[model samples]
Target: MSDAMTLREITDFAENLARKAGELVRREREDNTLRTDYKHQTELVTHADVMADEFITGAIRKRFPAHRILSEETMPDLSQAEELDTPLWIIDPIDGTVNYAYGHPQVAVSIAYAEKGQVQAGVVHAPFSDETYRATKGEGATLNDKPIQHSGATEPRQSLFATGFPYTKDKLEPLINRLNAMIHQCRDLRRIGSAALDICWVACGRLDI
Candidate 1:
């Protein structure tokens, strides 16, 4: 296949898979069927996470059997991801588990396609909002199929920053110091639980920093 066709195919697959996973998670949450657990006794995990991860990885395997998968729930081992001669898929089935448990609308399903250890395409799907953000390498990003770009704010005081906290709080001194600095320098800060959605928000000009 041509390079353009390959990129388009992979990107479409990622976007579709993300949407499907997002729907699954949303439905599970709405139906009150989520079984929650803790990973490393800190990070939250749910049965929805495992189900979505399996669905995405299984679809990728069927479509591109040779591709390597590094999913947050199932195949998180990254020892082999350092050197990527083949296509790789990175997936986060439910990025904001805590928020999802709390009925927050910040949950998302994130998927990325990488080749040669470089991400070539990505998609982030927010089920609650029914919004999908997508991008391909060498092309601009989009939100809900509309092109998006970052806000052209040059001054820090005019920008709105989004950040997340680590699951473990043992070494929060540095993070606190950074937050303190940003609070003073920037207009304001938002603590969005979903890192994937935070990044998409920045790309779509919703958040400047």
Candidate 2:
């Protein structure tokens, strides 16, 4: 198949799968019976995260068995090459598990397609807001099917920054220092819980950094 056609297909599939996984996240948010577990001392993981990861991995395997998968929940091998010969699907089934567990709407489903370590297409779905942000290399980006632009604010004082802090205390000190430095320079700061959503916000002009 032509490279253009292949990229188009990958982008579409990524957006669809992200939306599907996002729906699962939303449903799991409301289910009081859903179990929460810890992957680390403070990092949270829910059944919904694994369910969404499995769902996306299963679909990718069935549709493109030759491709490799690297997921936040399931990473069978840690020694994979940085530049792969085959396509790689990097997935974060639930980008904000802590928020999702708390029924916060900042969670999202993130999927990106990479080849030779370069991301070619990506999709981030926010089910709570019913928004889908998608991008392909050289194709720019879109929010809810409408083209979007960056804030383009060059001055730090005019930029609204968004960031997330690590859950563990050991890593908090440095992040706090960075936040302290940024707070003095930027207009304001926000911790939106999900990195994918933060990035989407930056793309669509919701955040400047």
Q: Pick the candidate with the highest TM-score.
A: 1
Cα-based lDDT at residue 76, candidate 1: 47
Query: Which segments of model 1 are wrong by more than 4 Å?
Result: 1-5, 76-82
lDDT values of the candidates? 0.87, 0.87
TM-score of 1: 0.94
The global Cα lDDT (0 to 1) of model 1 is 0.87
Model 1 lDDT tens row, 1-209:
22445787778989999999888999998999989899899988889999999999999888777778888745745665758566778899988889998899998999998876778899999999999999998888888889998888899999999998898999999999989888999999898999998888888888998
lDDT of 2 at 208: 95
**Per-model RMSD to reference:** 1.9, 2.0
Give the per-residue lDDT digits (tens) of candidate 2, residues 75-148: 64536546567778899999988888877888899999887777899999999989999998888899988999
